[model samples]
Target chain A: MDRQAWTTLFHRLLFTSAVWIVLSGTDAKALAVGAFAVPAATWLSLRLLPGRDRLVLWRFLRHFPSFVGGSLQGGVDVARRAISPGMPLLPGWVEVPVRLPDGGRVALGAELSLMPGTLAAGVRGDRLLVHLLDTDAGFENAIPREEAAIAAMILGTGKEVGP
Target chain B: MNDLATYAFTSIGLFFFVAGSVGFLRFPDVFSRLHALTKADNLGLGFIALGIAFQAESWRLVALLFLIWGLMLLAAGTMSQLIARDALRERDGR
Candidate 1:
């Protein structure tokens, strides 16, 4: 394996080990089992989905707070709209032009789905089809903002990559 | 103080869960129901995990709770996409 591949393997090992410790705790017997299990799982993971782009941790950390807050707000918004007697909803679909690569696009879709009133339904051509609970809920601004954040985290560059 | 936080968080979490269920029953279509179930239930689980974390005896258990919540968020996000895609396809008669 090349240096990049090795680095990816090492990171995967570290992550799988952390998951193992979380799952089985730090007991000696559990560690003994994990000794066999962790590496096997990491190897299987690499085989199934080899690392291509590394997520920039600091970038992700910087954006994490806002992402959490947005999703929380999303939950509250949906709950409020759902329980209201009027049941105010203006549900519809909107297409946002996709600018990032596949990995960044998937991350963007997932993050947008967790944000207020937006669920990414599918991709068409170079645009993402997002379902909105309310067309006028200001998703116009939110979607682009989230796309930039995911692009920064995955690609390490905030610049728009495509026209 | 800890008990107070636990109770408060748990109550808020349960409230969200109930709201999600209500939304599921009230929402008119599959897409709307998906919104309620995925978003509200995830936040509900997050708060409930936070509440449990407050009462956890060790940091390890707290970490475990957080990991579980994070995993759930990822799963819910991905599943919502798959479901929404299928629903759209079905509606289009594809």
Candidate 2:
């Protein structure tokens, strides 16, 4: 493997080891099992889905707070609308042009679906078909902002990081 | 103080869980119901995990709780997309 692939393998191994430690705790006996299991799992993971893109950690960290805040708002918004007397809903679909690469697009779709008032339904060509809980809920602005964030996270700002 | 926090957090979590269920029953279509179920339940689980984390005796247990919540968020986000996509495809008769 090249340097980038080596880096990906290292990161994946580190991640899998961390997961094993978290799941099994720090007991020597558990770690003895993990000594065999962790590498096996990491190898299996790489075989199943080799890393295509590197995540920009600082960008993700910068966006993490807002993402959490948005998810909280989304949960509360849906709950309030659910129990309200009027049951106000203007559900419909809107197609937004997608600019990110494949991995970034998947991340964008997942993130947008978890955000307030929007659910990513499907993809048609280069446009993402989004279902809005309320068309007037101002998602016209939200989706683009989210897309920009995801791009920054996956693609970086004007300088791509991964091979 | 920790007990009080646990109670408060869990109660809020329970409220969201109940609200999610209500929305699931009340929403008109599959997409909307998924919107309710996934979003609300994710938040609910997060709060409950936070509450439980407070009671955890060790930092490892707390970390595990956080990991669980993070996994739930990813799972719910991806699962909602898959379900929504399938529903959309079915609706379009494709």
State the TM-score for model 1.
0.96
Model 1 error, position A149 (Å): 1.0
- Candidate 1, B1-94: lDDT as tens digits: 9999999998899989999999999999999898899889989999999998889999889999999999998899888998998999999998
Q: What TM-score against the true chain A does chain A of each candidate get?
A: 0.92, 0.89
**A60-147: candidate 1 lDDT, tens digit per residue:** 9999899889989999999999999999898999898988887678778788888899998888888998999988887656888888
True contacts kept of each: 0.66, 0.72
Which stretch of 10 consecutive residues in model 2 chain A shows the poorest summed lDDT? A154-163
Top-TM-score structure, candidate number: 1
Tell me how each candidate scores on DockQ against the true complex.
0.81, 0.83
Residue lDDT tens for model 2, B39-78: 8998899999999888999998999998998998888888
lDDT of candidate 2 at residue A14, scale 0 to 100: 90
Off by over 4 Å in 1: none
